[model samples]
Target chain A: MTTPIRENTASESPRAELELATRDALGALRHVAACLARRSHELLGLSCLPGPAGQGRLLVAVADDGRLERLLAELRALPEVCGAQLSRAAGAALVPAAPVAA
Target chain B: MTRTTGARLIADSLVRHGIKAVAGIPGGANLPLFDAISQTPTRIVLARHEQGAGFIAQGMARVTGQAQVCLATSGPGVMNLLTAIADAKADSVPLVCLAGQVPRALMGTDAFQEVDVYGLTIPIAKHNVLARRAADLPRIMEEAFAIAVSGRPGPVVVDVPRDVQTEEFDFTSWPAPRLGSGPAESPGTPGPADLAFAASLLARCERPVLYCGGGARGAGAEIAVLAELLDAPVVTTLMGLGLLPPGHPRLAGMIGMHGAPAANHLLTRCDMLVAVGARFDDRATGDAKRFCPGASVIHIDIDPSEHGKNRAAHVPLAGDAVRTLGALIPLVPARARPAWTAIRASLGLAHPYALPGLDDPKSPYGVLAAAAEILGPEAVVATDVGQNQMRAAQAWPCHAPGKFLTSGGLGTMGFGLPAAIGAALADPSQPVACVTGDGGLLMNVQELATLAELGLPVKILLMDNGVLGLVRQQQALFVGGRYTASTFAARPDFVALAASFGIAAIDLEPCRDARAALAAVLAAPGPALARIPVDPDAHVYPMVPPGAANHEMILEKRHDHAHS
Candidate 1:
């Protein structure tokens, strides 16, 4: 099981939630964070959970949706990011951790 | 059976992979690799800095469309290479970067010159590996080449430890390499259904435009055939500059920010946009939602990952441009949209790009146009970033693919000189020209010594504006003209500087006829720098202000400081 890296209360402006599954390499997490900051995403919270086959997952939230489309495309295109998607539930905590393969 | 050190395996791999040369500087951690390389027939060009080494390798890869190698030591050496690595990633250049690290045991121990290179390169490289054992060298090296050149071509980092370099294992049998047929392309031709679907769209559209990018370089001939079939105009991104000759009748000029006015206007009006190998970068698409609101898009790219990432594709053709274009051409019906073609052509006159001092040969744009004429369309041109790069993009006539090399995605400065050297080395027969500015030239001026040593025929066309022209222009237009810290208070005598590096130099500022001086610079030199002094306030027109749409460009007539 894992916990959210951070979380924030709702603001006046629109917000979005993002989750990413990626390869567990050095600086992989930092790359995603930097990209998010560059696109001006608010980055409300982030959480890392161990994934299948030594992979890693991150849950993120942003304050603005103006540049989210391009931001998502860029995030998905990152070499380390294996998967990126929008969360169906707004402002949700880290998705329930999946059971690690025995 | 024979046993050999990991160092020997690396050198042997280069030979097996057909890499003829490498560029880098030597350091303590990398001394063993250099020593091993010395035994091989591969020639090494020593660069004064690691950044120059990486750009030199990029130059080779850009020209040959093959993976080239650059070497560096650990810690600071690897740090210096980060910019070039990121630049390659942005532009899709194929490069294999080999860096030396402290021994595996000393990793994470904060030993002397020990840096976490693997972490530093993760964000910038296509793929990277930290070689933990000597036995892994052969497979890792082979995989490095395969990954760098395959898929969307990009740089790969292989960090080898000092102790791993000396370790040896015996018994001769090596793992077989996974050699594919060619670089990443379609698994097979598009299916009959998909080809028919694309053909139907082409047949129906009246105002169709073919948008090409660097990925479409190999499919130029096929693109011409398809354009003729549809009577469509071709517009290219910065990377796709030479896919169509500058003089081609169907060429509609470049699109996006700082692009030709007619091209940007046509992009908005086109009913159907056949996007080939372009990902619709923000610079090209302006505002993604409204980019081509009325057009139906048919995006064709070799990489499946690029499809529908930025712009939705009505018909996404996932394959190599050549194969996909070839298959679809047979199904396309022949027709000519003469009316649409004439409309776009007339738009050029309607929105003419004004050159304030074009009649003066010493002007930045004028000098570039004059040089392009003197060198003919065959000369390979590389440009450093800022106003000079934009001017060259607008003025220089690129006749073929790989002829115009610039840092398009990353917009890197200090790339021109070393890349020009690499191009000259790749093809000694071709004339290489590097267009740079005073600010950019100073960034990698050390490579002037390297150029003198090789004595390669590379002409450096320096536009001396005495300030960061692009930044100043932006400040003038956007920031109330404060102009803080953009101007160089003290400047170098470029001619004397070049002479000190053993290169001939020419100053066009005082010449009665600048054209004659430029011609001489091109003709009489193994390596020379021609300085053309330009007005600091002169601006490149037809610019799309930051955060504006592509079509909403500020024309020359609109600017109060048009000729300043």
Candidate 2:
């Protein structure tokens, strides 16, 4: 479900991440990964971690060219996916610049 | 506790789901499952090709608006069924595909008929499960049907190993009753504010066009009511045909490439586009970015992803057509826009929708019209892609949803014949018309034998041109008419071929009264093929020439571009 608004389009971003609650079952990640690949969203990174029994969390980062909202909707629609939400960008570990090691 | 093999459980699941017939071709990997299903009341249809079986299932699903089943073995069988699965996904058809795989022990040992059905189907299917244990049969089968017909319905693949099928499992009882729901029950509904906003927009916009698509099927009355309420002209996409009667006054005719110029022209001038359950497919929306450039959108669809994937909806109402329209209808007041009506009429008069030689029974459009007239309104039409498809879209008078079945989203060439068979099987009482061209017919020609055996009232209107009509038309229009592989070296004598297959066939080349010949052939009984000799130079006109704007059609007549 989406909030009905006149200007609901996702703002443009070069990269974005989606956090998903998924079933901890065989081939469940395949369904999530396939959704991104089908839409030609270049997968930047993916990490899956075991949660409570029969539950898993998938954090996926993809190259987004202003199509993130639509992609988020598709990811949420997957059967194995219990929930999916766009992650806050500032929390991403991979920043463009970092302090050099001396 | 009841103890049963996984195969028996699957058969019981099929019975519990109210499936009377399942289509597929059995192979080495799936013999156990087939044996178990045979023991049940469900009749198994042995299709000549896996692809044929898949389309047969699609046919039933499309006609009945419910989930249908198809079976296939591993490796080659799964591979053959892939196209149909992809087609179902593209067109949003609900299908449960049960595929057999190698045994658990030999699964990764390079065993005979070993293929990774899960990985191959992941991208195409709504969801796919690899049933690794015999104990998982009940849950897996229930989930497969649930996922298939659920939101934005699509095909689901359930791959069970041969060992799992034969291995005995103790199951207390079936998990649930009727895991399947009709096409996901149309997702969600629009909020009251959303309806008010949409109604306000409708009231404000001077020139509004209601664009509907496949998702709008089974909501004909709602669409008609909305069109009337808004005083708007309705433009249906290729998949959205029969949402309203052909004679409906508000119909601007089908839109996009290979669509009517009047409707295409009207689209350019509309101020508001009320897209009812329509996804703006590239074929329907030529140069997506440029389609309805100045118009504000009120997008309504069952799927959330569709809303802003292409053109952004000014007021996106994410819900099924019926519920959304049912709510919005009362909010909007009835009014007439004479200017809009006059504009539509002027455009229509300039570009008369009726094709040239439409009355000639030997012509492309003529044969389909004759078939529809002879078969009457109850007839279901399933068309193969290309010129024959466009002709049927243009000429046929489909009165309701599901009456016109085409591989709209996938545009699969071999879909018509087998799908027609499935449609006929869904309701043997009604007649089915299969429209196909020379190119598409050969792709699934084996189904002709299936049609012969079934002896259903499926009148195949074969347009036999020496070339792949659409490809040749494209080559002619865009490629400087190089005349390459589009032309066939030698075509089969369709009449003789039909006779060889023990099915009656008639060629209209030499017939003095083609109308009467078509009538007699269509009316005679079981299955018959009528071959109409189409001119190789003939092409579907008002084409939006690839990558062009919808307004810039390559019209067949100069008057199409002339201002009235």
- Fnat for each model: 0.05, 0.29
For model 1, the superposed segments whose C-alpha errors exceed 4 Å read: A1-102, B171-192, B354-360, B561-564
Q: Please write out the lDDT profile of model 1 over residues B1-564, one tens digit for every residue.
A: 679888888888888888888999988888888989889988788988899999989988898899999999988898888899999999999999999999988889998888988777766887778888888887788878877877578898999998888888773655754432222321466678888888898899888889999888888999999999999989999899989897897788888778899889888788888988887888777776667767878888867657666777778787788889989999999997888878877887787765555566788888888888888888999999999999898888898888999999998999999999888878867778999999999999999989999898899999998999899988877777778899999989999999999999989989998888888889985999999897888787778887787888887657654443
Q: Write the per-residue lDDT of candidate 2 for residues B427-496, one digit (tens) a residue.
A: 9888789999989999999988888988888888999998988888888777777778999999899999
Off by over 4 Å in 2: A1-14, A94-102, B176-186, B557-564
TM-score of chain B taken alone, every candidate: 0.96, 0.96
**Alpha carbon lDDT at B306, candidate 1:** 71
Error of 2 at B553 (Å): 0.9
Q: Can you give the lDDT of residue B297 in candidate 2?
A: 92
The number of the candidate with the highest TM-score is 2
Lowest lDDT block of 10, candidate 2 chain B? B177-186
